[model samples]
Target: MNAPPEDDLSLGQPNVPATYFKDQRVTCEKDLYKSLPPLINGKAGYQSLLPDHTLVDTSNHADPNSEKGAKIRPDLGHYEHGVVSEEHPTMLDLIILAYEVKKARKEDIVNDTMKCTKPLPHDDCQAPYENTCQTSTITRGQLANYATQICRRQHRTHFYMVFIFHPFIRFIRWDRAGAIVTKRINYVEDCTPLVRFLYLFGRLDRAGKGFDPTVQPASQAEAEEAKKYLKRWEPKLERTVFKMDVPAANGKMRQFLVWGSLADPESPLGRTTRGYPAVEVIDGVVSAKPVFLKEQWRSVAVRPEVETLKELNEHGVLHVPTLLCGGDLPGQETKTHEISIGNWRVGHKRIDKRIHTRFVVAEVGQPLENFPSSKVMLGAIYNAFQGHDQAYNKCKIWHRDISGGNILILDNNKGLLSDWDLAREEADLDNGARAHERTGTWPFMSVGLLQQPNKQHTTRDDLESFFWVILYYGLHYLPHTHRDSLDHMMKEIFDQYDFAERDGMARGGNNKDALVRRGRYLGSRRSQQFSFIGCQPLTEFLFDCLDLLGKWDFRYDPTIQSWEEDGYIPASHAEMEPLWRQALQSPLWPVADRAVDQVRLSKRLDFIVRGERPERKGSKRSDPHDSIQDDEDDDDECSPRKRRKTCHGSEAAHL
Candidate 1:
């Protein structure tokens, strides 16, 4: 058979051999023979390497008949011939083994080192962790000793920060209206840690709200539930209420209404729109001035004038009622009448009288006869001063308008210091430069305060007014002759002492006549005797109080120290001892008894130390029968002991 031509193959056709060709003889070619396809010696062409048929081996490879095959031996270390020997574990194996050894050794080394060396200072030292400790125990003890000094320094820095940055912060959020409504809950479990802590500690109730001091305890389950809720929302409702700045619609006017009745209903003097005269509550009860009205006189003149009166009242440090609400009196009117109770106005009416344009209604308080005894009054005053000091520390400005009319008597025989219309921010203390004239009631106004129209009013002026009020309360008369108006009083004070002089009266030369005249007026028979005249102990107490004020320099001395240091004593030593002793003496003592006894004891001590002994009219041996006569006269006076008995017994209970 002949192979097909390449071209024929390409065309996909078979080619016929040329052996039977009719027109041509066959030509023998050696090359052509050599080119013929070669035959296979062993197998056919294009055969697969796999055998076609299987060969049966009678001797199995595992049979003993086969030399190459032997019974399978369980030789663990058998070596095969011609096969590459598995060389005794390569360098990698030795390296891995070495690594294992090194790892074990490293662990051992670590363990040994740990054992050899001491534990870390934090662990070994039983004290606080040294690494994170801020101070050693010794250092902390030293710091404790100087805590006050450190606090003072820190406080100075804090004050600087507050003064400099607070205004800016305030401006940023000044317009923000605080939360309007709030709900109080005892405690909630979902509350934050702080809320939970507060609730757990009884600081907050079960609803996670601030705990009311008067509230009674709740059941355990309710408390637990409250804790759970407290965690959900930290109720700061009470705090928010206090922080909320309730907007005052009118510019500066605030109105108030005190609800209570004065002891003397006939004398409507102390009646205020918000207080006693308008409304009658039980005596000695905690009465509230529910209504409030405040008026900010728009005109600069009116405001300044009113502010002057307010400042004078403040200066005298008189107790005034809080201002609740006020505005321009109704009608296009220039005249109005407002009743002032204590310092607050209860009601305001537009009166027909031109001179008395504004009528403010104030609640009437107790009569002078029902007023707190001298000791109680003194204590209240002291408390007021302390409050003033606290206000100063807070950088709050207080313009106390102290005056005879502003003072009031409470059923409890205590005085409440009220009113804040004239009060300015501490930052406004230097605003005196804006005013053209003195801005306070004349009699209480300091000399400098009167002369320097723009001179900043300092706390010193307030102290001077306090002195005047104290004198008035003791003597039942003004230090100077009564002037018809505020202006007249101002003029008199200025004329008597040249305020322009740096030294005030001291530098201008002592006006002894003025002092003596004032003294005489107070001592004169024409002066009205207060109801407590027979109270010799009270009289002596008043004298001692006067002495404390007299020792101080009332003028605006630029070099004066803080009020606490130079002007007032923080602790009333004489008063405290007796009260403390009394408190310890009777644990089950009635509140009224305690209060009265404390007052009486304090007064008695005061009298013994300062009061003048009564003169014996006739030199006669003391008679037992005469003792009752002496007692009658003594009882007329304000005796601390009598006061105690009255207070502890039915007197307080009756109210």
Candidate 2:
């Protein structure tokens, strides 16, 4: 450890003058609060070092009010000075660090997690080692949970965690790229390292403190200006207003005022897409018309959404959200990928590096599920399909992530395909690269892609995703008859996954694959199908669409392939192209443009679709077909949905 604060030697910490930590005696995890608070609060060094902050121990915190899972309480937190309340529980702004403590030594706690990113032999995957020590596994999970909770509660670029084991301390810095853990420091003999770290943490500015600088409080006037055109969502707190600066169409920095409460996902990781209906601030004047503003984190290697949107606009792709402006937020990217603690380098299979990104679209539309009538929903979906087709055929852009959330309905009820962050150009991605990273939303991702984790994303996968999006909204609103078994069906097909022993990732494609393989997309009886529903036209349209393309979902068993005698053809854009055509000529249209019944949607979403989310939905049995299944590529008889090369694995975190 470094010398005590009185060492008077210049040490390379963030802040200049060195401050000392109290020599508080502690034995185990329980004693950390009692012994350490003095170093942060009044008596020890709190006032002199971090006058504006206080360390609050909330290890047992429970928020009964939050419907969004148990508020994961960090053992201790460095927060802006104040008493913690249910409303401002974790201090959403100005967070210094989140701390977790394990009674065990640093080795026991840290070694619990496997270095999946290490350059290890493919056959010798480290995943099985995670089960070697049960306690260490639990501790690793807890540490990741704490880090994730902190990231969710606060809008931040990255955050820090102080993992303590009495004498030993490890500093973990977390970003979208993953985590960078420092070697352990023994703080029992000399407390300077912990003291100096905390002192400098308080000294750093807002960004240095890990808050997102792109977000700032909106003025009362700006908030009022945005409220006129923007719709609102009820957030945990009385909605806070904020203004974000993004690159405008004119190549100038412009401000957009967001009135609605920016919603955080249940898990504060991944794209964490924060979207809003915003109005522009131009020359001290707010625009009368509103636009859509979306902010999300995306891989640096992935093509920018703006470039794809501009490409679509240039090729005159139909039904796509019109690109106005916006690009990668300069100088705002993850810092964790650069950090590798010897054995743990960042993995390239998932996200290598992520950058904060912002963009605006001219159309301010409602979500796809909010369609007033069945025909409108069909039209919107049909329009989105056309947009996808033109983008693929004309511009050679593949929109990888197709979900109910990504489709929107305009005032005229035409569907607009949005959320192109994961879209890629065919030229740039001949193999549909980053299969693990930018693959679309979970429920809607093609079963083929989900089944074969390393599968290169293909147009066929996108087409399958399109079908799921339609079925998702259809099952929710079209009044399907499979009531008693709806919950089980949804859970199995959409949520079920088996941990691929090959890569150690949850790949839930068996049921979805079985759904197609058995021709059981719908049930057997009339009572099992969506018959005599209010949205009969929509139901009919869906069946027609499914029959045309879903037939191609046949399992491609290469062992029994015919050399032209069977006349088998792999799935292609030709089969899916008809859905868009049928949608255009679709005689049935909704009686009127209608908004979604939020209450109804919410209830069914939890019940039928998510199966009310059990303590854990009973896992589907592992498939004997662990071999990379194929969907049969037209040109190259490759594995399902054109599998990408095997994974180093991807995503938020596995631990």
Error of 2 at 117 (Å): 15
- Local distance difference test, each candidate: 0.27, 0.61
Find the 10 residues in a row with the least total lDDT in model 2: 646-655
lDDT tens digits by residue: candidate 2, 143-251: 7766655565456787888888766788877776566666567776666777677766666787876777878878888777766655433233345567888977676
Runs in model 2 lying further than 4 Å from the true structure: 1-30, 45-47, 59-67, 82-90, 103-108, 112-132, 234-236, 249-251, 259-269, 341-351, 431-438, 508-510, 513-517, 521-536, 550-655
TM-score against native, each model = 0.30, 0.78
Off by over 4 Å in 1: 1-372, 383-387, 431-436, 447-455, 477-551, 554-655
Worst 10 residues of 1 by lDDT: 155-164
Predicted candidate 1 versus true structure: per-residue lDDT over 330-410, tens digit per residue? 321211222111122111211221111121323223322223344454444544454454444443455444332234345
Which candidate achieves the best lDDT against the true structure? 2
